[model samples]
Target: MITASLESARTVLSEVFGYDSFRGEQEAVVEHVVAGGDAVVLMPTGGGKSLCYQIPSIVRPGTGVVVSPLIALMADQVAALENLGVRAAYLNSTLTLDRVHEVERQFLDGELDVLYMAPERLVLPRTLDLLGRGSIALFAIDEAHCVSQWGHDFRSDYLGLHVLADRFPGVPRIALTATATRATHAELTERLSLQDARHFVASFDRPNIEYRIVPKDGPRAQLIDFITTEHPGHCGIVYCLSRRGVDQLAEALNARGIAALPYHAGLPQEVRAGNQARFLREDGLVMVATIAFGMGIDKPDVRFVAHVDLPRSVEGYYQETGRAGRDGLPSTAWMAYGLGDVVSQRRLIESGEGDEAFKRRSMSHLDAMLALCETVDCRRVQLLSYFGEDSGPCGNCDTCKNPPATWDATVEVQKLLSALIRLDRERDQRFGSGQVIDVLRGKAGDRSRASRHEELSVWGVGADLSEAQWRTVIRQALARSLVVSHGDYGVLVPGPAGGPVLRGEERVFLREDPAAKKAGRSRRGGPQGRAAAPIELEPADAALFEQLRSWRAEQAKEQGVPAYVVFNDATLYGVVEAKPASIGELGGISGVGQKKLDRYGEAVLGIVSGAGTSDAEAPDREPG
Candidate 1:
């Protein structure tokens, strides 16, 4: 009894898009947009947010103008749409004038279904004039968080997008971002002039990624060891903070017999483009790059994301790590942090232009990241909590699975904060954490002697703890908002709440540093320790995994896409475990899209059958 309009929409969803139905709130969002309502969607990465806009764009009468931030993203999206026989084209700086004119002619002739443009290009007078002539369906702003100053990828051009709605009065608009805190979300909505727009906020949990933070003791060697021993033959990204670091790591990885390529802004435009193309097309290649690369990379088979250095903020960290296991595959999010990283990041922030408030906010964010690195609790839960989502302990992160012990650090905290207060009084606020620690430990070094704090009563109170232990306490105190480090005057001061605790009105229990905690062996005395190994596959299942991987490799070769674009390791592992017999059951897996199911479901199921596996379900382990 469905009407013609509804029936046609459903047909497109199933037949063209290869989706049987909408996921989460996608249907409602699509209907709202198709009905010409403005929307602001805050969906997490890999949550199918694209369909919320793409479906409506196709179902509505006119061409959808998708405003994307990255040139690579626009091209990749257009390519994917074209693969589905959707008429899509992009106009960006990369295109020549002749091609731009041709695309414009097509847009005016109604030959395109969706046209993607960068925010910088879309704000142009000529571009706006052409868009006025077309029947504009919707204006979708992807990565909309970039419009806010608080966001990691802030772009001034994005603020100009508000004019699109003003210029084209009747067209619907949607702004989407994967990572945005409540504050950032409010700012984005206001800046985009979407006060009247409907809002869609999806859960920010990425349950499949296993988070781990290892101390940066010989980071390069550890990286080489991890890739070779733990996750051999897997595709991963190694993120560094600098272009020089990227180049060095790439060279080191190549020397160690791993295929790694360097990608950064310093490289020639064409060379960077070529390197990225190669990484996307080849299997088992590691890309060592700065944050400049890998924004709109569609490769889903990235099995790991390792940071050779610390990211500036949690938002940047989450976005970088979220790139892994996008196909809902089991992957590792690993990083190596050390004292030097803390100093380097702080220096970079201090070098930027900002007032007191901006600097304090930036420092607070960095302190939180440092706390995350030093945490002995579940990394996944902690990360989700930062984004305003809460979850029970995820057993997949390193600390949760193998719980670290705790110690009473109430006395130690008092001693450290008191030392800061004493140093502030003595030096008139001209010292950092190291000098404060030195004065407390009663070290007669030149720096401490120059401050004239060696004779203070609290100077040697914390001498009982080792240098490493003091560092841990300082980081924890900072994390708990018990202290703050000022960069301008370079002083360590008590935080707002630190006063009461120093006065003995409050008590705090602290987790022992993981490195200081005792290491135990598994009951069976294996290297994996007492924590149960992530569910292991039987020989037949392992064989099937290899076959699936090989088949994926072949398909990737044919399409010139990463193997993950065909199937992620997690999906392949799920197949080995679930042994789904039909397309319906295969589609039930977390990351199996309808297009992927229709294209490769039977072959995947065939591997299951050949392994003599029945459609048996295994008990789900706490996702570690």
Candidate 2:
């Protein structure tokens, strides 16, 4: 009854998923898995990861079982799949016992094509027994990086997933993740037992999302300016480091009429669920939350992801920032970074309960993030390079537009490094950046006097720079591995990497402190280049685009799903521009599959033909 070929895969992609062709590695991943081969797919978020296996299940002879961590939205995804005329259902805790039995019956009777469940549920003996009763096309492990203890998002339940491999030897298992450092990638492969699987590592670049990092000068006010100016009347996310910051920032934004809601682990589970659902359904609502939120959320229209505080690692930042602009719209990834963030992150790492090696790894991660934030090169290049991918400078980031002012900090850095050496030799101890700065500024502070640091030759040598300038130098030093922030009291010690800079063998260049530059601010948005810019509809088709969008919104609300789930913005642009007046022409459109054309072709043509009419009159079926 089913055909297994590339042609069949293409047909299923167009008809069932409403996609015209396979993106980057989707086709290869699908073909490999459809032929009963394992894979570890390293595509970016919104790189169409779901379709890699979804189509194989359609082309192959059995149902595909997906293990996902997002318990709340698995039902919504099933709803979306069923909307496309696929026999899909989820077996999670949300279903009643009888309801679960109904789905199970559907599977047993071969009525269901795909079944999604959380990892814990799928690992249960009863669930395994149920799967054993039926022929499984493949086993897809979503968010597979969670199996790595080296990852920040490690889950204990995911530790049980390796059993799936042993239980189903011949079944193809595809492990997928959006974020993985080299180490995490190896850990994912080993922990999930997918060593021989073909690795499909996609380019980890979110080009539609502009990257920005601003000095935290009155961060709250600066954040207000950014949102009110750039992202008014748009849904976005603001991430804070602590639960208290989440609550306070949410309240502050609400007071300013921003319509924000707070979400964190501190809240009750029901409240968190409610907040998440409301964020999904509502328009233009800003969700202020801690990193505890947004692990598995699939909302597609988040216009920006702003950080009031720095995230723990570059991986976390990449994962978090990828949440925005999922619809491929022009969204932003903005953050406010200050020296205090550096100190706080250092303190947390030093005072953390993890073992020494874990703490060192975490500190290394934090240093990578700091390097990203402080880099004068393209943020996109540095970010992708961290994941073992190479890319040129992306003109979309703040660095490309306002290109940071670089100072020849060789002599100044030599002075700073000399001060550290002085502290080690003269004081017979290491001091934190604060005491070092005080000594360098010729200030007789209590600590400086207690340690007799004034007698050192490096004392007062950095007086040519202001206190803030010196702090920036120190921050940049830490970023460049010229200094280390470790020990119990967050002391500054020079690492071996600083030897060349201290000996003047290597020239050091640092982005100048923006505080010194008054006219040109570093935190402004600029024009960017898109990787694949969508073709815009002509002016004559403007009304039609809005009409089509309105119909889409009403239909999405009717179905209790996001608008993008119905039809993406690019597809709508095609419909308006091409002005398809029949099912054949509709099928010619990119997002219009055979199933979609059958269901919504008449509705789309009605919008195209009813030109110059009041768009207030809604169509019965929407054109997505």
lDDT of candidate 1 vs native?
0.78
| Candidate 1 residue spans exceeding 4 A from truth | 1-7, 374-377, 417-463, 480-503, 516-537, 551-555, 562-624
Candidate 1 accuracy as TM-score = 0.82
How well does each candidate superpose onto the true structure, as a TM-score?
A: 0.82, 0.88
List pairs with backbone clashes in candidate 1.
301-564, 329-570, 396-624, 440-459
Residue 269, candidate 1: alpha-carbon lDDT: 90
Name the 10 consecutive residues with the lowest summed lDDT in model 1: 524-533
Every model's Cα RMSD, please? 6.6, 4.4
Query: Lowest-scoring 10 consecutive residues by lDDT in candidate 2?
Result: 525-534
lDDT of 1 by residue, 1-624 (tens): 555555666667776665568777777777778878999998777777888778888888889999987786576677667656678999998899999999998889988889999999899998898999888778999999999988788889998998976898789999998889888899999999999999988888888888988766678887877776556666789999999999999999888777888999999998998888888767778899999987767677787899989988898898899888776657889898765676567667787889988887898788778868877788888888888998989889989877877888888888888887776676575466788778778777876676567778887887898777787777667667787655654456888879889999998777665562222222321222111113356666666777777777777678766555566566677777787867777777755666666566666676666742212422222211
Per lDDT, the best of the predicted structures is 2
Clashing pairs in model 2, backbone N/Cα/C closer than 3 A: none
Q: Count the backbone clashes (under 3 Å) in each candidate.
A: 4, 0
